[model samples]
Target chain A: MPSTAGAALPERSRDLRAFAGPVVEWAIWIAVLAWVFWQTQRFDREIAQYAFGAAGWPRALCIAAALGATGQLIYRIAEIRRGRAAVPEAAGPEIAAPESAAPEGQKPGLWQRAKHLPIFIFPLIYLYLVPSVGFYVATPFFILGLLLILEVRTLRALLGVTCVVYGLVLLLFTRFFYVALPVGRIESFYDINNAIIGIARYGM
Target chain B: MEQFLDGTFNLFGDGQAVLIFALGLIGGMLFGAIPGVNMLTLGAVLLPFTITMQPEHAVMLFSVIYCAGVFGGAITAILFNIPGAPENAPTCFDGYPMTMQGRSGKAIGAAVSCSAIGGVASAVLMMSATGLIASWAVRAFGPQEVFALIFFGLAVSASIGAENLWKGWLSVFAGLIIATVGTDPVGGIPRFNEGSFFGLEFSSYYLSAGIHFIPMILGFFAVSEVLTQAMHISKGTRERPKAGLDFPTIAEFLSVRWTMLRSIVIGFFAGILPGIGATLAAFLGYSQAHRWSKKRANFGKGELEGVVASETANNAATGAAMIPLLALGLPGGALTAMIMGIFQIHGMEPGPLIFVNSGDLVWITFAAMFWANLFIILLGWLQTKTVVQILRVPFRWLAPGILLLAVIGAYALRNLFIDVWVMFLAGIVGYLLRRSGYSAAGVVLGLILGKLGESAFSKSMQLMDYNFFGFFERPISALLITLGIAAIIVSIINEIRGADVQKALMD
Candidate 1:
């Protein structure tokens, strides 16, 4: 059945050709293991000569792991051949449909969806900006931004919940956990931050 | 052993330990009840206070949190269909079904009781076994064995990612690479750090910036859930959890006796393996139980046995994981690793030396685990009613509140803005991968075990002359390797003849 599916595809199309799930899983692993092995190749080869040192166990383990990894790569290849192949399902509910029907733009295909790089990249940008904005400053905005994207209703509820939640967290961590929350430069704001810091450092 | 016995007696004698246990019980109940809050965050949030505590007492607080976290997750899972942890995801299957049938109280009761039993059983196993294992492990000086043990750990994790072995391996390798990003432990040279970003070597290795697990955890479990919840809310209809608890009948529990016993054993054994942790133990135990269950067809549709297997195995894994941690000074899971870190920062090295050098602390910690498990039962039951109430909050209010807490929790880890970003990215990845049928737990476990396996393997290489057999030469290492091989065969056999095994076990 998979062979027929594969044959039906355009011969030159590199993407979306039918392949077994196990095959795809292995192919991805081999690529990763190969990269790791290549990264350690020089040191791994050099370390092969030295013996009977304080470093003996750690180095040997690495090479053994590389070997184990290599063995797995081979096994995966074999397993992939024995299994039925899959082409990403083109049929699935759309995300934009009714909430019970589908989530926003989610479909069954994998390769077609990887094109949306922005979704994956957004979080990284958020993390980079968090400490600079400070917990108090950043959390409400993060909450508000995420809610808006998901199309949450009622701005009043969102604002109320965001403030209450953020305020509660500030009370808990600062008062209870005593975490040294980041407070960017400001002489006037220094004391409050310091008091929080002091509590975190000593009180808890 | 004598000291361990004495420490147990001490907790009862002084009542201070009991008070600590109470705090842990309450904390675990509350943390587990809330959707966004998890044990790791609770542990981290509570860590600073423990710094001034006696090592044993400090460990007790965290241990209570661990045991309770497993059971606590079911509160919302049963009532709201929201899993408190990734491990608890399976719980929502039967758990919520029982709730849907208006047996919410009974479901919570059975879950709590089974979880407590698993917890206490593993604790008993750990107490009895730790001394014996520690004595042997402490005396054994085979670098080959250590390397092999690490290999065994890697294999367990690798096997868990059966269909997606490659992605699993990549996750492990990524962790290994991350482990090497800092200064080489033996070589003492910065291998991965390009240099100071602005004249300061801003790296986990050079700057002693620890890789904060809590932030990562919060990001993956808490933050991701919030985003998913947000998406669900926008869809119009939201799940509102019903409140309350029910005590189980004697017959109901008696029928599950064999399952409970089997799960406890599985949990205990899984716990013994380093880095395997409760989630896998619960998963494996539940899978086995499901395969063998008389009501196999009722599993995903919400069988009581499903909840029993998952909860018991997870809870048992908690205590069992500590066996390796205490006996060998090798951490059995991520949370224990954090505790191990605390021990190191406090100038206590966990290996064989710990048993001999820090005998008092060792005994105390072992004793603490035992009592903490017992305390988890009392704690779980006490907060049973209170916790079920939290499930009553409307999804809209609860979702935003949880989202806020997730942000705070992520930010609290290292007080870094960047971790918040990591959480966000992980959330998106988690959501996307989950939608694609890839398990988020797999990813997290991969990220975790991958690094440990790499470091241990590398350490072995640095010692031996790249001889692969170094892993097998040591007796324990060889045993673990054998177990890994056998487990793979068993998993395969089980998968192939799944129906037969299910029939035989159920019968």
Candidate 2:
């Protein structure tokens, strides 16, 4: 009986660990709602007498959110207590790794998660370059960079795909639709675009 | 009925109209068949070009795209087990299984035929119902009634959240707060700007201009999908199934006729209700099919009825979703919201007045939907072999191209760099919220409804002479508000029951 009881103790502790992340998330959400409520105080108070004033709806929504978050936190706590567990497993991790490493198995480490970071980072860098390098110049490089990050290693396949995609987009958006893609500081960009459009339309 | 016939003939009379319809159908199918590329993204990309076209042509193009896009997603679902759109998620249950069993042709055939039938039926329903609803709404609804309806929409949307009801409500509140950042709809005063919080120049122009829906959508759906897919780049691809033009037998079609009809009814009604879109319709339809079937054990194991149930319902929703948009100016889902934006761009507001003002345009749009569904069936049948080939495209190749389109779509909205930044920021926020079990649908619904809700509330306040209780004085508004309350109560009870079940499991 002692051995069985000892075995159940670790299982209960693991359950508690699972609940920790959700509890923290709920607490953070509550704090954010409280901040939102505080922020509403800064709205123009002179118009507060109106039933649907500038601040009226916002204040109501903030209060409701705060209360909801508080209720969720309390419910989660009660759940933990009643289940005789420290935590239950956090939701949203069934598909991916959990927020924290479980005692039973390996969690996805920082490096594993960071591998996908370039998916987002590349877009930011591409957008930043668009205004300076111009869309026509920046797009190919963006496509090339993404393909590389996605681990497409064959250079021939990369260039061929990039050219096809870029050429189609350029022809469609710039030539057919006349979309004014940003030309950056390059005065020659327009000339190049027009030359391509002219060739496509009237033939070389 | 004569007007509908005339509109249908008139649309096909012009050769340009046929060309545009064909283009939209083909384009929508190609884009939507690719996983991570949806109708909304394709619509956003094409929105800029529509400015140069005639308004009727533009409307027809988008309407066709909307219909075809719903059908397109099932192809990938059958071939790849990855749903091209959220509405097609349920199709994957039996669709991919059938592909594994080498019955891809039968599954595809049923999906195509049922989708077209469901779309035509829903379009007919929309044609009959929308005009009546519009006339009634125009007569009976005031700002109070509109506010009550939008409130009900928010409640329904929150109840459908993927996680806990409270979290859904929280997301809705957060969305409402985000919507409040720009100029107040009632007062035209900028709230939550740099002046209100930090004294920074960055928020001056962009905040005043407000967050464009196009950028927000492109970020949330397209960029987030790109990132998610990027994470799975290391996964190996499956060999493409040999798709053939094997049309379903007459007997098979007859067997599922009742299921198809039931799904169409469910999908149409669900679409009429604001914020409950095709995803829910598909789910409800599939579940009902399983419940009503004799061979329920075969449901998830390559059942043809499952494919029919999901595809038919989702396709049926395409036309029914437009009912609210045309009648009350309330968009029920993302696709309809984008269509609403197009309506606004064409200088035609999509409220009850649209029926009175541009009734011809509405009828023409309805006719266009019928033709679009026919085109989907005809074209999908003819191109089954080619369409299925899209599944063989590597994700590594597909994701970047979609990312480029997302950037281009975001930029084309207003030709402002700030809009691009907004899209990026919204994408990050959407990703984080989605990762935390909060539904992005709630936030998006809140954002779409926020300004309309605010205007209605403010108007109601003025109409009632500042008496909050006066909302109950109107019969329809009172009924709607009661419904809203009932919805919230039901959601909470469900949440509590779910928690109790979880507790029992743990114990």
Candidate 3:
């Protein structure tokens, strides 16, 4: 009986791990809906006579989201329960592979997910820099940083690709389309920028 | 026929018109082939330049771009797993598989051919039926009917989440909730902007403007893809396959002729409906193909018919989407919405009366579309010769380039820094939802249709003395509502039966 209990432990744990993502999603949905429902109370109740006021659609949507999330939670739980019993070891590799390869102990932590952090962070940093540094000034650095994160080894290839892409965007947005890319702190920079634009448009 | 001939003569009579058509086709194709940049972005960028050209030339340029952009998205979808645009999502289901099978050239050829055929067929349909369809649609659809139709669109879009009906419904409702952030369509009163909710102060200005779609699309599809690819960067490079301009033979084309024809019909009708864009048309077309095909089991595993179905329907919707714009002054999708702006800028209002007021311009535009389709076939075939080489570039190098384009595309929308932040937030949300097996397309469809649906519902309420159930009293409205309910039931049944939900539907 003791040996039997030991064998069942890992299987049970695997099932729990599988349910973790769905549980978190459900919690997020519920929280969002709760906030939405609370906000609906603030909408003016007297504006429209028909079909509920400005809050009507939002309130209905919130309720529907709550119900849907609840239903999904139940369905996912059932699937996990059924899957553990019905799925066999002798089935196809795609189904059996996960069970056989299950980690013996604790799941990987935040450190394991850290590899994806830089790629996600790059966009955020780029956006923050765009307004102050301006698009033309910010883009090359942005591309250079992303390339380094993506593991472009050689400096030559990195600089070459960055320059080409930046030049093309500069020509297209500034010269051809005349899109007002932010000028940043230096107002006198416009003279040089306009000269480059002139060269692109009508030749020096 | 006379008008078409006259339009054709006028188009060729001027070298400038021909040059503009060629440039629009090439430029749109290039933009659409990039993963994060779409034709609508290209249209927005070129909109300023159109100010300098004749109104006829501007219209012609936009028409060419619309046709080429729709077709160009399939190129990357076939060669890479990434879709160039949302409408190309379905194409990636089989297209990337075909690439894995070293049939990239053949898949691309079929995609281009079918897309051109679908575009030409819809253009013909538009020429023949736009006047009649417009007049009838304007007369037949009141706010109540339009609301019902939008509700039906939402239902059909939700049905796309066949793997998880509840999650799909949740996504749809979440999208609707997001749409309600701005001022009410009827009352002009802000609903969700208060001092603080959930410990975050809601900005009245941001809430009033609401979220833009392009930024959301870039985040959901492009930014999320970057994160996903980053995780897999350690997998090392795979072997590259040989690809070229290998157009399908007559027999090969004939084999999928029936599929293409059905897709064209499906796409044309889907386009006529307001707010139902190319993405939904592609999904519906692919789903119908899976339902009808004998080898449905082989669909996601590199089936040629899958590529044909998606590309054909998406491009076909391009022409059909223009019908409402030309007929009722109602823009169908982002691309048409921008085109409508261009029309207004050029002093040619696009309504039923446009045919009378700007008959020559209308004929010229139709002629341009025809020429544009032909031009895409030629230019696309040439593009295939070199585009396949993109796979040879290391993904590590390509990833950063894509990221740059994604940023630029987001910023280009309104040149607003806040939009960029919105895109980043949307990307995180998209990544989470995708990891949880929820459909991002459902969320996007909901976003697209939500505003239209709410406004129509509110207007209809005003029309019918506040009785919500009165939506079902009208014949067309009743039919639409019944269809919407039936679609939900069918999707639920499909889910219960454990049908093989195609990844194309999960976009």
Candidate 4:
């Protein structure tokens, strides 16, 4: 696809994307104002105690803001009216930086390549398990898992760092700050004193 | 005179007071160094711990945190690309550019010095003009006037949007709409609560939508910024350019001194005006400095003078904000408002009676605030030298760290993880808005002013039986409205002129 530039850019047209931005903004502003006015009017007519009598500074200010917003939309509309909205500008042809920079068609995907579902599911799992397993139990595994997924070298390094971090948090929140940690539902097996004593007995 | 001396003596006399100031200084610096951990959180978190202490000591610590936290935010803002506080957001535009240019040390120095100067200047003005400013605040600002002041804040923010005024207003409008969530302030009517829609019946009282700030600040300033940096990450991070915390030369100092002075004055005056916060103070100072600068074009591109002006104005706002806080028990910004809560919690009512009844305590708080400013300078300066290296942390790593904190912080705000999700969603929206060239300052300011504007406007109408001009009967209200209109007109003229200049340059 040849790049468009300068004269090649769209000279004039009612581009939907360009027009949609301002239209949406205006609709939002109008809807808000109408809603407020209707609410205030209704309240004024209802319970006498609810009546504010007339439009005071807040109403006037809302009207003024709505006008300002409308004016902005008008200005943007004028820009589109003139052929000068953000018509896609052209640039020179693509040049790959060295071939080794990133393997062709192998960029690190933000979420997933074709819905790699676990990337989304993992965070959800962590979020659910966090309070239940407690910060101490959940944090180390979370850190370790994230590190492994990110392809951080060396499992030792990952575990070491996670343990250090987990220990530090446990000390700060539970010991120093005295923030109570949730000891999961299996209270019969979990001993809170043992965990605290173990940590105090042997520093990370 | 006797009271002032006694207050000063009492400050130095108490050992606990020293400890309180020290804790405030350290807490302020720590919080200010971390983006999203603003003074409000630090103060509020410490509030419980200080509850059992003497009122004077607690107040001293609170004021110290308030003042130091305001200045301490510039630390991360200068060293890293992130602003620690929402008010310091503007500082990062130039402050970070300076750091990248190997002037990080001087940037921090300028920020620290100007912060102290601004803070002290505002404190002095607050002490001298507290009574007069209070009367002016109450006498002049009816609903009409307060609304105008909010308008002025938006205008001030909008003018700084530079070439993207449309996008700026868009964000402001977005903020305005979001602010309308919860309950109607005047009539107590529930509007837009979406009850019975998803089997979600929120408490009406809670629905009067008190959005958490720290999470929002984190979302807007930290999360979005980190994501943006993450997208652009290339290779290993560069070593932070070394400029060992050194003050500017005398000539350099002389050049920016006037900017600092002017910004302090502007900041103080804006602070004295109730309902305005550091954002407007900062915006006004930056624009005023640009208007005064010999090389105005160098402003957004890391000018030392620009940093001076912004830091001074924002920091100076601390004490100026206190005037209303002390005199009328009305909070200026979120943090100071929390301080007002503290005053109330401590059984010290802040009003005309506070001046008469607790005059000595007022002086003591001011003194503590002053010392806090000084301590921020010394401690912040030393920390700036050592802290530059922390900026080398990868955005990839830092983002996760911050995200972790954000989750915890939001949950801690009211012990609800739902707030954490709200924060994440807000961050996404905030990031999109930023990428689209909208100002977050407008959003924050709108959020702050929106509720106040609504309630005040409603009350004013009720007081006057809906006669719109009833507010103008007061002389002060009329003057503020006139000035507000004039500011808008001037801003428009300047913007038009700027556009014309740009067109000419293009031609």
**Off by more than 4 A, model 2:** A1-19, A41-50, A84-104, A110-114, A186-204, B1-115, B126-131, B159-161, B195-202, B234-368, B382-384, B499-507
TM-score of 3: 0.86
* Stronger candidate by lDDT (2 vs 4): 2
RMSD of each: 7.5, 6.3, 4.7, 6.3
What candidate 1 gets wrong by more than 4 Å, as runs, is A1-128, A185-204, B1-18, B31-111, B126-130, B137-213, B235-252, B269-307, B317-372, B459-465, B470-475, B489-507
Compared with the true structure, all predictions reach lDDT values of 0.59, 0.72, 0.74, 0.64
- Kindly report the fnat of each predicted structure, to 2 decimals: 0.14, 0.32, 0.39, 0.05
lDDT of 3: 0.74
Interface root-mean-square deviation, candidate 3: 6.9
Tens digits of lDDT, candidate 2, B1-507: 987897787788889888888889988887677654568767877888878887778877888898999888888777655456767766766786676566777888888888899899999988888867545545677789878877875775562323456776877777777777777766676666654234433346567776665566566655654564565553222233455446779999999999999999878765666665576577667767865776555665678998999899988988888887888888877767777877888788887788789877787889999889977888888767566555457757876777776677677767788888887887787667656666455565566567768878888988899888898999989998998888788767756665323223434
Docking class of 3: acceptable
Q: Against the true structure, whose TM-score is highest?
A: 3
The DockQ-derived docking category for candidate 4 is incorrect
By DockQ thresholds, what CAPRI class is model 2? acceptable
Instruction: Write down the TM-score of every candidate.
Output: 0.70, 0.75, 0.86, 0.79
* Candidates 3 and 4, the one with greater DockQ: 3
Q: How do all the candidates rank in terms of lDDT, highest first?
A: 3, 2, 4, 1
**Residue-wise C-alpha lDDT for candidate 1, range B1-507, written one tens digit per residue:** 677788777766667877887787678767776665678778776777777877777776777777777778877777755567756755665676676555677778878888888987887777677767545544663454544554554554442322234333444444444445334444443443333333454334322343344445555555555555555554444444456467678999998888898889877766666655676577666666765678755664447887888788888888777766766678866578778867865777776567678777666666766666666666667666666676665555665566556666666545655556656666776565434434344445444544455456556765665776766767777787787677556654543443333223322
Query: Residue-wise lDDT of candidate 4 within A24-140, one digit each (tens)?
Result: 968977887765554444223243643543233335546766887777787667766665635211100000001112223445565544333332344456667755655556656
Question: lDDT tens digits, residues A46-147, model 2?
Answer: 454354667777777777877777777776666565665443333321112211222445456888767767877888888887787677767788889988
TM-score for the A-chain in each candidate structure: 0.53, 0.70, 0.72, 0.50
Off by over 4 Å in 3: A1-24, A81-111, A185-204, B35-37, B41-55, B77-86, B159-163, B191-204, B235-252, B295-302, B328-359, B500-507
